[model samples]
Target: MSPRVLIVGLNYSPEHTGIAPYTAGMAQALRESGWDVEVITGLPHYPQWRIHDGYPRTGDPHEVIDGVPVLRVPHPVPHDAGQLRRLGMEIVFGLRAATAPWGRPDAVVVVTPALFASAIVRVRAALTRTPVIAWVHDIYTAGLSETGAAGGPVTHMMRAVEGTFLRSCSGAVVIHDRFADYLRGHMGVAAERITTVRNWTHISEAPTVDTDALRRRFGWGPEDVVVLHTGNMGAKQDLTNVAAAAQVAERTGAPLRFVLVGGGHQRPQLEQLATTTPRFEVLPSVDNDTYAGLLRAADVLLVNERPGLTEMCVPSKLTSYFTADRPVLAAVEAAGPSAAELAAADAGIRVRPGDPEALVEGAMQLHDEWITTGGATHRGGRRYVREVLSRGAAVRSFVSAVAKLLPVTTEHRAPATVNS
Candidate 1:
């Protein structure tokens, strides 16, 4: 009899980037490891507000993918930008998860994309008596509060609740050790309970792109100093600085073209501004293979997250950039986990947030260096990912944790059901 492992989260595949890849990869790997794997999640509205096109609404259940059975539960699409709607979605998903039908998992692994996600699963774990593994994708309560997403009263209350949930978790899995340290030192979670099983990219051996054709297709030139910004276009990005920096780059005759690739609510406004401005091009979201090709094709990969999100979040896209072996130009905090990783990997240069002048200067410096040297020096991030953070690695760590909690019993055979 094999152990049964359950992974719970909100977004998942065929969703792109962010938490989906990690959750889906981990579940599939656990199934490969011979565990009876199940994944329970809310409707996938991620990146976009609407429900994913293929699946039906709440009462209509779906197993959207194969291998591990994915139980797509319900949550209301948030309307107001208000915590009322957002928190309601979390609460609704949690409440509905209680009614979901599935054979009991020997161990439950819940992903904390939000501070509230852990809270919901904590409630579920208490009733089930199952060991709960909390996957820390972001240090959310602190991240949101530090960035002023919540008020003083709301911040204090949510932070306290989140801390309580962290302490309650049987294990807290963070992608970075800095986040784990913050949890141990600030939130009072014991050191042993937190594991650093970071996110990974599925590496490609052969190039998945026709780099030259794609470049021509996108109107990039041989000498166009293309600085590519790929992934979420959202408020957390201090785009005022990005815009201002573009202004500076244009003024200085840097002959650079800024590429904003991917979709989000913030994109249209950013696009409008860039269109009215100069040397900026906004491209729609690309498939994974195309995105990777674009990364390989670009002169420098740019990351422009606000300073506030630095330590609390790790842009998983950085992993992709490093794997692509491209030089980086980052508008991230000068100090923090991201900074440290960039410096350590010698992957890119960082500029302070809200200072577009510094951004222009940094971009100029990187461009000069890249031109002189002819692109990136460091490689092997893909190799590093395959060795350390692959799906196999995450699943082994997950299953071993479950084995500690639920030893397989001699008579414990899995109940037969549809392979959904």
Candidate 2:
């Protein structure tokens, strides 16, 4: 009879991507706090657009990871990034929602990777009258259309879908305040019903892998200064700036190596750019464990995004870099949400977005500074993440939000997420 919470999202880990880490961490955190939590999601394959490396499709349809029950239903592997492919994935998961056997939890938390995922949750919630907490990552209608991945009448249609989805929600959680504003100002979601619950990665243990040893395998030298970018290489990230920055490193003999990991629509462009540049190397993504190692391995973690589009999205990669305790060089939209975090954290340097020359100069200078100071030194941001951004803290914030959504129990109130 404990509180049971259901989280629905796409590309959850062992699944890896934006919401994956949050979904996995939140489910485990809620379970740890004595609430029975289950995640209802699609079959493992995303970004790669294939099933997860070792996991196989099963007739049983339900799997468990680290004691948190994962109910995986069928979803299409849409290789073609067309409207049909996108809709195909949403339709399959929406149908699975009806038939998936994860018991109806007292309250449901739906994480939207795509814009239309909310539409599905809205229909289901309306049918059952179940309370739903819609957690907005990036709204697909605006987010993807902004990226040109989803557009035309589809964009208009998605905006309409988002309208109803937000209206149907009992409560809404947005990662950054910009989104909360979007929900209220644009989607007509009431401000009182929305809360800004920041996204963060929770770590139980600090990284144990030897970054030097990792570099050895990846063809980077112990003395090499690494500029690592982890997570999606999407259009919005504007990785060409990273490539331009890498060119500066190569020219200046800065001994800086740019390692691009994770996948996205912009991956091919980054890959093509890297192919012509020796200082930049493309490494296929490893599991979450190896990804953690890469975070710590880099002397400089690059968290850059296109300028002007900052409020539309916040990079989850910043959480990983901050948690790993590495110095960040964020070349993002000026005065964006992430810039605010970087400034407040005093973590690393920030350059104005889209100015390739400025980005290169800033990156080159930061590389020189790191090498001159001590390449391996951790920053205040790392210390801050340890104190504030830990997994326990993140889950507690999410759990409390879920608890609040569950009619104000007035028992076992959880703490909010902090810089740790």
Clashing pairs in 2: 202-391, 385-420, 388-420, 389-420
Give TM-scores for every candidate, taking all chains together and pairing residue i with residue i: 0.92, 0.88
Worst 10 contiguous positions by lDDT, candidate 2: 411-420
lDDT of 2: 0.73
The list of candidate 1 runs beyond 4 A from truth reads: 58-60, 79-83, 203-205, 376-391, 408-411, 415-420
Candidate 2 lDDT tens digits, 182-232: 888778999988877677764423666776788887888877777888776
The most accurate candidate by lDDT is 1
Name the runs in model 2 displaced over 4 angstroms: 80-84, 150-157, 203-205, 251-254, 373-378, 407-420
> Which numbered prediction scores highest in TM-score against the true structure?
1
Local error of candidate 1 at residue 137 (angstroms): 0.4
